[model samples]
Target: MRTPIKRDDLESARSDLLATAVGWFKREQDVVGIFLGGSVAAGSADAYSDIDLRIVVQPEHHLHYVERRREIPTQWPGFLFNEWLPNTQHCVSHFQPFGKIDIFYYDAAKLTPSPWYRLQIRILHDPRGIVTDLVKRSEELPFLVGESDVDLSISKGLAAAHETYRRAKRGELFYAQTLLDELRHHVMQADDWLHDRTPETTVMAKFDNRASGEVLSSLAMSYCPCLDEAILAALSSLARAYRNQVLALHEKFQLSRPLRNDVAALDMVA
Candidate 1:
């Protein structure tokens, strides 16, 4: 039977692997830099988290460097290993030793100005200055500057809100389904941008911090506005709460920027 790897087991294995790697580095005097990235470095590691490792070498040694480290994983068995050369200067290695490992390679100078630059990183060994320089450079890297389009939301939202007013004007139920759908999309899009995840939690509930009131009000007013006063009051409360959330994210991340309606407004909200 293949033994199952638990979170504790992965942590222990990483500790052991790092120990072995550090000893090898000390012996291999030419090896200049080593660092850890990915989930462990971010303090969000779990059993499924992969080890992200990087090693920097001297420029002259780049030609034969892959040949040198290719055998490193043989030190530990039961690991499923795969490796790739991302560029002439870099190699990426994946090792699933009871868990997963993602490794990167680079020369000392190539460490900076790479798109893979991560904010949170841990240096295992830096006999030369490459690791420190990369860390310093990462802090100064630019943040996201979103693209802009149009804010058709004002007209769209008001139109939908007016429809709900009409429904309320009639004796029928005041449902805000259409407005709710649009509102949900924008709120969800903003969350996706913030979390950097494709799928996020639901937009409902008082605990959901990312909801938007303008979106919600437009949604609610588009819905069953002709419903009883209590129902309308509840929808109004939800819209207000969602609006507060939009404002908060707007202040913190500049998420309120206008954008092309070409992309779904929700997708562009962030």
Candidate 2:
């Protein structure tokens, strides 16, 4: 059985695990390169920050490595539990003495250039200098989503929010909240696009723009358990923010404005 971990011992535990990982990577022949990113590479890691690793392997050995990914934590010390994320390429492992590591395995030949590739990264092992070349190429490429995609996201969020309001009016509180969650997700994605940030698994608190962060915080706090109150609150917050985003898009590009029909459906006095 795995021993219980104390919160106070998490940092030291993670440090030891990282050292073990670096050593293992250096010795593994199939592993072509290893890069460290996320909060640690970004220099913003706190006691609560989890370790993130990008493992690049030989193209021919990609499937072999991925299939055996579960064995990774066992090779290290203090592994407690692990959860595979929806993406087969990613996994999160928890360790004894309290800590988590998020690992992403990639085929060196199949790796694509994106914002993540350019983020603060430390190449731990690159015998052929493949990662160095990729990093250099990533810097020359612009990481951006098209304006049309941003417009579509805003429209989807508004439509979902409207449906959520309708569901709440019909007394389907659970389903309404479910749709509200989707609306929130789309809104956050739109925010990411506005700032030229990758929308994937973005943490709102890490947003560089203070106004965007405040908007997200306000929308989160607007959620309520009461059905009618929640519906109105969610719709109001979404509509307000959606309008601002739409206006910003129009100002920057020639995008069409989002319709305000959803806000009109809400009964403000109720």
Candidate 3:
């Protein structure tokens, strides 16, 4: 039988792994800069936060690191396993006694300012001032959610709601449920935009803590059993809620609704 990794132990393990990883990268001549990103950098990290390590390699040496990204973390203490993320230069490593790290290798020359580092970042190592310069340059980057994005998400959500209702009526529970899930994301994005939160930020991060009571209340009605009647009821509730969100966005951002269709499929959704 395996013993559980308690909250305290997990916290300690995480810190230990981070220190070791950062120390290793600092010793590498090809590593021009290093910084911490994600929730940990934002000061919102909980017991399970993964170490989001940004490793800036000397351009010519970047490919060498990318080729062996997965293998690099094996030298860290308590090495268990690691997974390669879609981006070849990114690697997600998991450790035995329990810890996780997301490492993204960047060529020093290609680093640019972006909204990603807008929240918070900790410079672990910046021998040549590369990471420091990136942070300074990123300070002026703004987060933008245009009118077109809000309109599309709202319109697409309503269309999905209509399709979900039809599918549920036809007894196709699987696809209906899938569409319901997708519709949740659409509304979530719309809600983020309406609240002036960056849509590209973490999905539903501390939702109950940050989201308005109205959004919370409507979101409650969006989840239901897989049964046809229940699914249809949920879709109806979500359809109206999506429309209300669109109206709110219009009032907030002065964005025009791109598509207002027949209410025959989704009543009161204009």
Candidate 4:
């Protein structure tokens, strides 16, 4: 059965699932701490939001847990399956009756927090006060992007759009579309820095909630149907938007706009 995006029963079921998971983690001797992140931690969760559960393991047993990360999520009721985020210790656990959870494993001894905790984290279990203290320290750190990062983001975005243009001209729509999507992320990162917000670890998530309408609207104008001509036009539009953003970022951060020559070369495309 398809679950409604917003429903009271689904909310109740999710709360119950979270409560049950909390109980299980608290009883497990090796599990040191538990905290929520993502939309749940930000207090903006809707019925469809996944429970981002950070599971802190006993430092001595961290390796053992990491080896069998799949075993942990399988313990949840109604668990359909879990998929690991590539090259990371995080898993997205999907369930049948109601909801989903993102389980992130952390080593208790090696716990080092960052500014991410300031925006998205709610501690539920911290017996040793380790996670609590780290979170407090992280919250004090400023969440601003560096000039080099902005330069890299805009340069790469423009480069990707150029690649997309080349691929579209060659009739490789799929690959062109792929690069176009990558360019979108580059735009998002640039936008984050333009407004002095920290770029999210998970790209393309919560951007709608955080970004200004002007940024979004400009990007929206670049979207087009998946036809060769349409895609070529989209690449052009995206390139123009990036150019404008480069100038804006230049004024805001005194960025060097190192991609001016590359962008000029890209604009020579028909």
Q: What are the Cα lDDT values of the candidates?
A: 0.52, 0.73, 0.80, 0.77
Q: Which runs of model 3 end up more than 4 angstroms from their true locations? A: 1-3, 80-88, 155-163, 166-172, 198-205, 262-270
Task: Please write out the lDDT profile of model 3 over residues 211-263, one tens digit for every residue.
Answer: 77777788887788889888988887877777677667767878654334423
Q: Per-residue alpha-carbon lDDT of model 4 for 1-270, expressed as tens digits?
A: 874555786788788889988898899899989998777777677777778888899888887777777787788787888788555777777885668887788998887768777766788998988788888878777766678877677668767877888898899998888898888888777777677665343422578867778778867876778888988887777777766766777778886655566557556642
Tens-digit lDDT track of model 1 for 102-201: 5555766555563245446788888666778777666545544242311333334334434433443453343544444454455445444444332112
- Model 1 segments more than 4 A misplaced: 67-71, 83-97, 113-118, 146-191, 194-270
Q: Give each model a TM-score.
A: 0.50, 0.79, 0.83, 0.87
Which runs in model 2 stand beyond 4 Å of their true positions?
A: 1-8, 85-87, 192-205, 212-217, 256-270
Top candidate, metric TM-score: 4
- Using lDDT as the measure, which candidate wins? 3
In Å, residue 200's CA in model 1 sits off its true spot by 18
Worst 10 residues of 1 by lDDT: 198-207
Residue range with the least summed lDDT across 10 consecutive positions in model 3: 261-270
| Quality of model 3 by C-alpha lDDT | 0.80
After superposition, the stretches of candidate 4 with alpha carbons farther than 4 Å from their true spots are 1-6, 198-206, 256-259
Evaluate residue 195 in candidate 4 and report its C-alpha lDDT on the 0 to 100 scale: 72
